[model samples]
Every structure is written in structure tokens, then in C-alpha cells.
Target: MIKIYSITVTTILLAVVSLISCSSEETSEKKQENLSTSPATANYAITPVDLRYVKLTDDFWLPVVKRVQEETIPYAIKKCEEEGRLHNFLIASGEMEGSVKGKMPFDDTDVYKIIEGASMTLISAPNPELEKELDRIITIIGKGQEDDGYLTTWRTINPKKPPAPWVNVVEGKRWESLTASHELYNAGHLYEAAYAHYKATGKTNFLNIAYKNADLIVKTFGDNEGQIAAVPGHQIIETGLIKLYALSGKEEYLKMARYFLDNRGRSEHHKLNDSYLSAAYSQDHLPVIEQDEVLGHAVRAMYMYAAMTDIAVLMKDADYENAVDKLWQNMVEKKIYLTGGLGARHEGEAFGDNYEL
Candidate 1:
């Protein structure tokens, strides 16, 4: 059953990788001449074969994949509904009247991640029912957005009262407490799920929501006059923007992604004294290129590394590539556990210092 579950999840990831590669190929060909200069024009070293072309005929794997499609996806969605993940969206949308209905500030991502998983499943196994359900979920999610494209439901429901007590928001406005609030992290997952939904069904319902929020991000956070010049306390938004740039050929998305990575660990860009914004807690101890060790929240480190790698390949950046290489070497040589788990400390869900495991 575990093997089946792993394969099921692997197929979902394959869908994301394959679809992104497809966009990369198209974008690369059109801007072939600009490959030398355009950050969005370059391609990754490897591209996965599209799920549609690859048949899962192996007796063991095929059953697992089918089980995921037949059982897991539906079960997961039901759990999300039971957990109030869906209700939070309705509350933010004003379709329901209640406080945010989750314990975590980033509970919106539970719905987004499930949609992404379901959408990825749709790529290999087309299901009209699942697609329609996703559309309904997407509509609820869309209705949660503020007039200016902001869509963090907890904050939208009540900025002063975050869903999680640790979120540290005292009459917070948007982006006020970026580190603990997870405002951008919510946006990142939204973009990812939207892209997957668009890829699977070619529908604009979710994609449009992603685009509108991204446009607002581009306008809100920057080095320009009146814009907030700060990076996300958590990562992944960088890669999310890159995905959008791949689809829209929008330079702003690509640049914004680069901006987030470039400003990490730069104290002058934004003060980082919060408990969650520690120099290493979120991997903000050093600028991304200067980061040699893989210390921090494991998930955030991985996401940041992904964006770094994307920039390294896309922009042909030697510094970024070197840093990524060093971080990789450090992880494999000293940090990684025997079980292949990346994080060792459960307290922070972080990597331990050199063999601390």
C-alpha cells in the first residue's frame, strides 16, 4: 500500500514536471535568440516525458496509480471538507458567515495542494467528475479574493485575528507580518494549483485567479517607490511565479521571482528579527547565492533550492549554480539522515547542524 501511495504521488509530480517542461520548450523556441540574456528563455537540463505519452502498464505500479485515482483523491477531498478547509474559503468569500475555520494560518493551502494533486491525477487519467469538482472549488476560492486580488483567507476574514495564535498579527494589514502570517506562502500554493488545473483541463477559472493575485504581488512588493521591499518568510512563491512566467511569458513574474531569491539574507532589504524570521530558520541567514549549508526548515530549503536552480539554469547564473552545488554536497555528505529524510529536528522541522542526527 505504501508503494502504491508513493507511485501515486510520483505520478502527480510527473504531471507537474512534464507540463512545466512543455511550457519551457515552447517558450524557449520562441525566444531562442534571447537565450543568452532572457532569464525566462533557457530550459532545464532534463524534461520528463508527458504523462499522456507514458503508459503505466507495470502490473504493480498500474494498480497503485489506479487506486490513487479511484480512492485516494476522493478520500482526501472529503477529509478537507470535513476539516473546514472548504468552509474557510466560503467564509472569506462571504458565502458563509463564520471565523476562519482552521488551526493554521496557511490552511488555504490544504485546498490548493489537494486541487493540484487532483489536477495532476487528471492529466494521466481524465475524469470529468473530478474536473467539475475542481471548478467548483476554484470558484469558492476565487470568491475569497479581496477586490485588489489579495486572497489569503485567514487574513481576509480578520487580519487582526490570525487562525493560528503564533501568526503574530495585531491589527495586521496585508503583508504586515509576512514571516508568520504565510500570506505569500498561500499565494504560492494557489499559483501551483492553478497552473496544474489549467494544464489538466485548459480552464481559465483557476488560472485567472492565480494571475490576478500575481499581478497584485508584482504591484505590491518591489524596490520601487511605495512598494514593500521584502522577501517571503517562507519560500515556494519564487517557483510559483516562475511557473506563471513560463505560461504567460511575462517578464514581471520572472523578475519578481528573481527578486525574492536575490534579497534573501540581505538585512538591508528587510529587518528579520521575528522568531520565525531567524537568519537560518527560514534560510534567510545569507543571500541565496552565498548560502552554502542546507540549514533551515526542510520544506522551505527545498523550495528555495528549486527556485535557485531554476534561476541558475534560466539566467545562466554561475554564482547561483555554485551555491546550489555546495548546498547539495553538504546535505548528502553531512546533513541527510539514513532514512533519506531531509529534516532531523521535529521542533522546527529543520535540518540539524552537521551530523547532529
Candidate 2:
């Protein structure tokens, strides 16, 4: 049995705070001083207090946070390098050789996520050494990116031979199979990590990489003549783009985010037929606004819900808000495990029959 972590609600709460804090106009003037950038002026439903304003002095959450900063962050970085997570980036950049060295197509995200976590730690506690280490990782990531801003190491290294045989390799081209390729999923993590780095250190290196890639995403996908009207097989990119929009005040990023969410489950959008690519597995069985049940990969559902909540408040769309509320009730009332562990079934890392846990 998969040992699931009991942090689903906590993750959503943190994401909600991160997203809502920026768009909230009611953030007090005193809180604004601690923010890396001025609190966004966009109208939102809940204005979360800035992390800098909220200190975790309590014995419970404080040590947990510090352990991540003091112990987990260092250990993870070492393992990533030792295990070739960092070297894949180097190999993709021609700094090394041989085939991809990871089990998953999206292992690059491990590095990005680690940096994101460390950056978040820096936000609460100033750590120059940790910040510098993150800079080193981001620099390597930038080197691995393709000229047009694509950054998936496996595809870039050998698209014809994906790390996993299950990934459909079509002419070794980028964006060929959005459903299983996980290209967008990697970018979503990159954007999240880069934005965190920016917030933590005021550095633009990683953020610029994200911006370039995001711009390409906006350029590549849309309802226009040449674009692909497709949604991600996995979610989280929508919320990531939304966060970028909140930070940069760029309407296009917000539009692309909304586009991804709106296009899900529509015949007009791309579809997949693989065993795991089914609509329900990826939360694409229905339009997000019409989705009531939190079906699919549990983490994907959480990310989508976070984005939906953001849309509800940012766009003031009552329908989206209502949909999210219904989904929340469904999870809390029926699906959630007693230990707060979600995704009870490890088969697809997905939700199970109501109250199966």
C-alpha cells in the first residue's frame, strides 16, 4: 500500500493563501512592507495575510517548517544531484551523455520543487547560502532549456525514445501528445518554483525563464487559427499561470490559464484514449465549472480546485465559485480519509468510490 501523506488540505490552504494574498486589495499597509512586491489590486474574495506578516511561533508548525529548511532541503538537493536529477539537465545541455536517468518523464520537476520549497523557506527566514544554492540550481535549469524556452529534459534529450515506452512518441516533436507527454505539467512546476524564487530573493533569472516559456505557451495554444485548442492531461499549469498573472499583472497569462481550464472535457479540445488518459483520470471528464465530484488524481484535483477558487474570486464568476463549493463539500463530506490522507487508491493515484477509505 502506498503511504499517502496527510497534507492535502494543508497544501490547498497554502496555495489558496499564496494566490489569494496577492490579489487581495485589503492587505493592510503594514503587511505590504514585508511583501516582495506590492499587494496586487485585483478584487478577490479572500485576502490572505502575507506570509511575512504571519509568523509560525507555535511549536507544532514551526519545527516542521524549520526541519524542511534545515534538514530536508539540504538532503533533497544532495540526493537530486547524486541521483542525476541535476545531471539530466546537464546532459540535455550536452554537458553529459547517455540516456535519461530517471523513472518518470517529469523527474526534472523534483529539482524545481525542491528549489521552490527552499525558496519558500527563505521567505520566512533569511538564508543567503540557501538562496545562493537555489541560484545555482536555477542557473543549471536555464542552461537546460531549449532556445524557444521548452525545458523537458527527456523530450529534449531524446524525444523518439521517451523515458517510458508508454509515452507515445510522435516524430519526436514537442507538444505532440499533450495528454500523456507531461510537458505542460513540468512547466507548471517550473513556473511555480521560479515565482517562488522571485518572491524569495528578488532575482529574475528563473522568473525570466518562466516568462519566456509562458509566453511560448500563450503563443502556441489558443482558439486562433494556428493554435491547439487543448487542455493539459494533468492540471496545475492553470493555477501556475494564474499565479504568474497575479504577480506580473499580465492579462494574457490569466487568459491562457482560463483557456486551459475552460477547454477541458470539450470535444473541441484534444482528446486521448489511453488507459490512464481517460477524462476522469485527469479531471477532464467534464468542464471544470460543471465538475462536482473531485474525480481523478487527487493532487491534480486539488490544483484544479485551487485554480477554480482563484477564478471564482478573480473573475467574480458565480458559476465557477458554486462549482468549487460543491466539489469541496463532496470531498470533505464523502471522499476524505479520516487521517486526512486523500487518494486512497494507489492504482492511478486517484480518488476512489465515495468514502472507500
Per residue, candidate 1 scores C-alpha lDDT tens digits across 79-168 of: 989999888888888889998787998889989998987876665566788888888888888888988999998888888888777777
Model 2 spans with C-alpha error above 4 angstroms: 1-28, 32-41, 55-67
**TM-score for each predicted model, relative to the true structure:** 0.87, 0.87
lDDT of 2 by residue, 1-357 (tens): 111111234344554545533323345674655443432323532344444343344455556777887889999999998888999888899988878888788899999999887887765567788888888888899889989888899988988878876788768888877777889999999988887788767889999999999999999999899987788877889878887886788989988988888888786567654434677888888888899898888988888888777777667778887888888888888999777788879888889988788
lDDT of 1: 0.79
- Kindly report which residue pairs in candidate 1 clash with one another: 279-285
**Scored by Cα lDDT, where does model 2 land?**
0.78
Question: How many clashes does each candidate structure show, in the order listed?
Answer: 1, 0
True-vs-predicted CA distance for residue 55, candidate 1, Å: 4.3
Q: lDDT score, residue 17, model 2?
A: 49
Error (Å) of candidate 1 at residue 124 is 2.3
Distance (Å) between predicted and true CA of 210, model 1? 0.6
